[model samples]
Target chain A: MTAPVDVSLIVIVVVITALVFDFTNGFHDTANAMATSIATGALRPKVAVLIAGVLNVVGAFLSVEVARTISSGLVDEARISPVVIFAGLIGAIIWNLLTWLLGLPSSSSHALFGGLIGATVVAAGLGAVHFGAVLSKVILPAIVSPVLAGIIALTATYLAYRTTARADSGTVTKGFKAGQIGSASMVALAHGTSDAQKTMGIITLTLITAGVLSPDSGPPFWVILSAGLAIGLGTYLGGWRIIRTLGKRVSEIETPQGFAAEASTTAVILTSSHLGLALSTTQVATGAIFGAGSGRRLAAVRWSVARQMVVAWILTLPAAAAVGAVAAWVASAGTVGIVLVAVVAIALAAGIYAVSRRRPVTADNVNDVGDDAAVAHEPAVPAR
Target chain B: MTIDWASLGLVSVVSLAAGVAVVVLVSFALVGLSARVRPRPGGAEDGAPTLSAGAGTAIAAVCLAAVVAIVGFGLYVIVS
Candidate 1:
């Protein structure tokens, strides 16, 4: 058995790391909610992110079901330790930063799950993970949700165009821009409820492992508030790199397509959250934008950019898992090992940040697609 | 463990239907409002059709209300 002081110290470290992961999750996914709105000029980038951030905080308070699932459903809490969760968070944080630097909106959800599962396997063996739950809850939904969202968005976009074809173009554009605001707001709220809970679950599980909370206990009030605030603050910072990719690189979205895509994403994400399916909002939004782009004209969609994003999605789980496994192996050696891993992770994050500063993507320049030759050449939007 | 196929199916159906329904409704609203200009009995002086503030306004309002109701239901799902 571990000494009380050691356990408490590790628990604090794990909790802090979990919040760091939550912060990354927020900025990584901000694009999912506001990209379309910003792309179509429905909302200014600064205002869009601010609204999303506020709604995210409110959305986090509305549900705890997803948090409960994370705390108990994915892994056998009895066999794992807080140190393993810490290593897993480190893995997730690294992957999120790497993907963000590349402007690839990969699945932060999958990264977290992979990190936890990988660390658990390294520390407690494969049996510690509930394979059935991972297959049914995680894997199946990941395969289905995006495809489902895509199809729905495609159909919706087609119908929108058909129904509005005879209407005055100026009026139609104005009306859909108004609709986009409401739909995108819903996506932000749904994102908060779904994504913020993952961090809460990890922290709750850590508390349980540290013997500070009972098994099967829900996330405490403080955990919920802190997780919500971390993600909210991150969202306000705005992940401009990914926002640019989803907003402009994938498609030259008109107001109607933006409205349709955002509405479809909100519908799919909220329903999945209610059913307790932890899905990637990035995948859903990307799929919806692709659907909207294709529904208008197959050739209009930038297949090249979409393909690159797909490749990133495929790599997220395994790449994060590999990192998590290595971190866990090092951390299990002792306290000194944990500190070493933390130092190395911090240095790597700093390095990535320094590299990003060279070609910084901020809200002011997020819509500048003219610099990207591959996207600029597309016929969708005329290069400025 | 068995996959909860029922819940999965339910989510798929509801999301698809709601997504299509909302966009279609919004489009119809825009159409109703935008199509309001009818050619005057005598051709307009500037060749621009005059707005007929009649059934079109009513139809647009109904469609817009339906959208609001759907959005409200979504909020209900989150809160409940």
Candidate 2:
């Protein structure tokens, strides 16, 4: 066994890194709940994020389910060292930051899972990983969840427009805008419960591997508290770039479309949760918006932007896995190796943030996509 | 490992029923309430009232109540 000091220090570093990943997850996914409401002027950007942040914290406290077994079925936890988990986290954070820089809505959960899989294979070999679980849990849901949500959104949107077709256009818009606020709030609250729980699980998993906690033990109060606050703070900060991509660049959303998309997202997420199918909120939200946009007018949907998102979704797992493999090699060197990896990871994150400042997207102009953002990803999207 | 095909199918059905129900109920409530408008001369939808004010408001109230009930049920499911 390693020295006592080394074990404790590793535990501390792992916990801190886990919380940092949680924060990024919160901010990266803010668009899932608020983008549509913000796009249609149903809720102010600042107010929308505030609601999401508070609800996320509240939701975290609401559930104390088994977080220690987050990757139990996907990988052999017994062979996973704290250093391996730390390396995995570094990979996930790097991917989350890179995707955020590009204003893409890739799955944060998948990044985390992919990182763990990559690190585990490097640390314990291919036999330790579960390919069947990966196919059924990670890859299948990534492909299926969005398609299901999109279909529902399409049907819901079509019915919404059809039933309201005869009503006063002005009244219809006003009514749906009000409805958007309620549905969007539910999404925010639901996001809080699920996403925040993942962080708590990671922290608990780290403790288990580090010998600080036994297997199958629930997260302690402090783990839950810190995870919740970290995620809440991140959500409050908001990922404005991704919000711009989802709200403005996805489609020209009207109030009715926003309402339909949000409602569909909420319904799919809630139903999946009840049925024990874990899906990514980012993917689900994007699909709902896609369906809503095309349901109203196929011509309004930007195919180029859709293609870019698809590319990002397809690349997320492999890219994060590649990074994780590299980090695993470096971290396996010993305690000193992780400190070096952490330092480099922090510097890279700072560089990404610095690059993003070149064309900042804040709450005031979040709905208006910049010409460069559109032209780079999609030339067909004219400056709004 | 086998995929949870049964759960996935159930999710699709439940989501469709829940999502479509909410959208339809809200639309109906809006339509019902629109009948109560006084119909100003310059308004885009200036026309004779399609239904009595009492009847329109009652329909809107019932539809909106159903929506609220459905949303409440959703909350219960989420919590449990």
Report RMSD (Å) for each prediction in the order shown. 3.2, 3.1
Per-residue lDDT of candidate 1, residues A278-357 (tens digit) = 88888888899999888787777888888888899888888898999999999999999899999999999999999999
Regions more than 4 Å wrong, model 1: A1-7, A381-384, B36-52
The reply for model 2, stretches above 4 Å from the true place, is A1-7, A65-69, A370-384, B40-49
**C-alpha TM-scores of all predictions:** 0.95, 0.94
Q: Highest DockQ, which number?
A: 2
TM-score of 1: 0.95
Fnat for each predicted structure, in order = 0.85, 0.63
Docking quality level of the chain pair in candidate 2: medium
